[model samples]
Target: MSPYDDVEQTGMGTHGAKESGMDERATLLDFPGADELMAAGQVGEPSAQALSGALARVGTAAAAEAAGRGTGDVAATPVRRLSARRRVLVGMFTAAAVAAGAVTYANAGAGSAAPTGTGTRGETRAAGAGVFLNDMSTVAASQSATTGKYWKTHTKAGDTYLSQSMDFYVMNDGKAYKKGRRPDWQFGPKNVDWKGLDQLTTDPAKLLQLLRTPAKTNDIAPFDQATALLGDTPASPKLRAGVFKAMAGLKGVRLVGAVKDSTGRGGTALEFQEARSLGRVTVDPKTSAILEYTFTWTSGPSKGKVTHDTILSMGFTDRIG
Candidate 1:
C-alpha cells in the first residue's frame, strides 16, 4: 500500500479498537433475537453461522443481556465512542485555525516596519517656513515708511492730529494670546480715538509718515510699529534693532518711524542679510519716510529657545494733514 493509505489504515484501526472496548457491554444487549433463533434450532444455516460468529466475538451471555435491556446498545454504543474522538480532533483543528487567522490579521495591518523620516508634520513645517520667508521679504519693504513727496505736510491739534490711519500687516508669531488679536495702543496727544478717526485719511502710508517724525509728548505715534517691522529692506536692520531695544523698556507700546527719500527720485533699494534673525530699517532716499523694517525672532517652550519666525509690513501715504 502507499504511505498515505498505510497511515490512514493505521489511524482508523487504532481508533476502531479503542471504540470497540467501550461498546463491548452495549453489543451484548443486542444478541437476544439471534440467541432465540439458535436455541429454537429453527434458524437457516446461513443465519446460524453469522450469529455464531458474532456470538463468538462478543461472548453469548453479554450480548443476550444487552438485548433484553432494549437500550439500542449494539450499533449505537460504538458510534457514540467514535463521535467522542471526532470531537477532540475537531477542537484541535479549530484552535489551530484561529491562531493562524490571528497571526495573518496582525501582519496585514503592520504597515512598513521602518521609520519614515518625512511625515505629515514635517512637510507642514517645511511649507510653513517657505511661506514665512516670502512674507517676510514683502513686509520688510512695506514697513520702512518711505515717502516720495517733495513737500510733506503735518498738522496737530490738542492730543489729536488729522484723521489719518496706518494699516500694517502683522504676524503674531509668538501666539501670545488666546485670540489672534492683541491690545497694541499707546496713549498720547496724537492717539486719536481709534473709533473717531476720519475714514478718508486713514491710509497707512499717510499715517506712517506722521508717526516717524518727532511729535509732541501728548501726540500718539502715527503707525503701529510692532505690526510694520516684518519686511525686507536695507534700513530694516536699524529699525528692527531700535524697536527691539525700545520694547525692552516699555510695557504696552505704539511706535512710528517717518522717512523721506533724500534724493528726488526713488532709486535705492533696501539691502540686508536675509537669513539672520535680526532687525533692519530702510527709508526712501528722497521722501524721508520710513519705507521698511524687518525683525527676526525665535521663541519656544525651551528656556529662551525660539519657536517661530515672522515679519510685519507697513505702508504710508503723503496725505497726512
Candidate 2:
C-alpha cells in the first residue's frame, strides 16, 4: 500500500453542502527519520517502514521528474500522485494503515493544567519558517489549556468537494472520529483536551516521530490534519510547540510573512511548495491560535486556483448540538 497504491483516496468528509473543484496528488515515500526514530524506539522496525525520510526527499524529486520536473499535477481531484513526503508514509505507514485500518490518533482528554509559553510577535513579525513555528509553539505552550466535552470549528474553505469552491462553513462534532465518512453539518466531536496526546513528548525530535507515526488513508491530508488539529482542537501549549517544530521540518516549506485571512484578521504564515501546489498556515499574532489553512495552485492549468479553511472560531463545548 505504497502512497502510490492505486487505492481510491478521497478527501475526508469533504462532500460539502455547496459547490467547488479539486484534484489529488500522490503520496511521497518518506525515509526522513525512520532509522533515527526506530533507534530511539519511536516507531517499529526501521526496515518495516516504506516512508522513512530519505524516500520523502527522493519521492518529491521523483514526482517532479515524473511530471517532466514541472511542478505538480494540478488537475483532477480523484487521482492521487506521489510526493516525496507522502511517498514514505503511503509507501510504508499510510499504506499499512490503509490496508489494516489500524491507524488511530489519540482522542483522550488532557489535563486542565496550562504550560507557560515563550516569545511574542507583533501583528507583522517576520522570521524564517523554522523560527516562526518555534516561536509560535512557545506562545501556544504558555496558554492555559482547558478541557471541553465537545470540539467545534468555524472554518471557511473553497468548496473542497470536487471544488465546491464556496464560502464560509462551520463544523461541529463530538470527539468521535469515524473513518470514511462524508462531511457533516454537525459532525461528531474530536477532543481538544490533549488527554490522548500526553505520550507525545515536548522534544521536537520525539514529537515529530509521533506525528509521522500515524497510519493514514491519504498521504497529504494527514499532514494538514496533524498541524491543523492544533488550532482546530484543544491541546497543551507544549504539545502545540512540538507540532509546530515537527511541521517546520517539511521540505520546501518556509515562512511567508504577515498576511490577512478571508476575515481580514492579521497573522503570520508558513507555507510549503508542493509540486504545483502551495500550502500555508496562518496564525493569530497575539493568541497564537491558527487563523487559516490555505492551499493554492501555483502552476498548471489551475494556476491561481485557491482553497482555504479559516478558523473563525473554535473551542471546547459542554455538549453537542
Q: Each model's TM-score, in the order given?
A: 0.17, 0.47
Cα lDDT over the full model 2: 0.47
How well is each residue in 1-321 modelled by candidate 1, as lDDT tens digits?
A: 211111111235565865655454233223211221122222122345544543343344334534654664434444444344333333222222212221010011111111212223212111111112222222232233443221121211111111222222221342212223222233222433223322213323343344455545633322233223322121233343333222222222211112223222232222222223333344332222344443444333332333222212223334322
Looking at model 2, report the run of 10 residues with the lowest lDDT sum: 104-113
Specify the highest-lDDT model's number.
2
Candidate 2: residue 318 Cα off by (Å):
0.5
Q: Give each model's whole-structure lDDT.
A: 0.28, 0.47
lDDT of 2 at 9: 35
Q: Report RMSD (Å) for each prediction in the order shown.
A: 40.0, 23.0
- What lDDT tens digits, residue by residue, belong to model 2 across residues 111-181? 11111122232111123555445445544644567766545554563111111111223323423332332
Number of clashes recorded per candidate: 62, 63
Where is model 1 more than 4 Å wrong at Cα?
Answer: 1-278, 299-321
lDDT of candidate 2 at residue 251, scale 0 to 100: 49
Q: What TM-score does prediction 2 earn?
A: 0.47
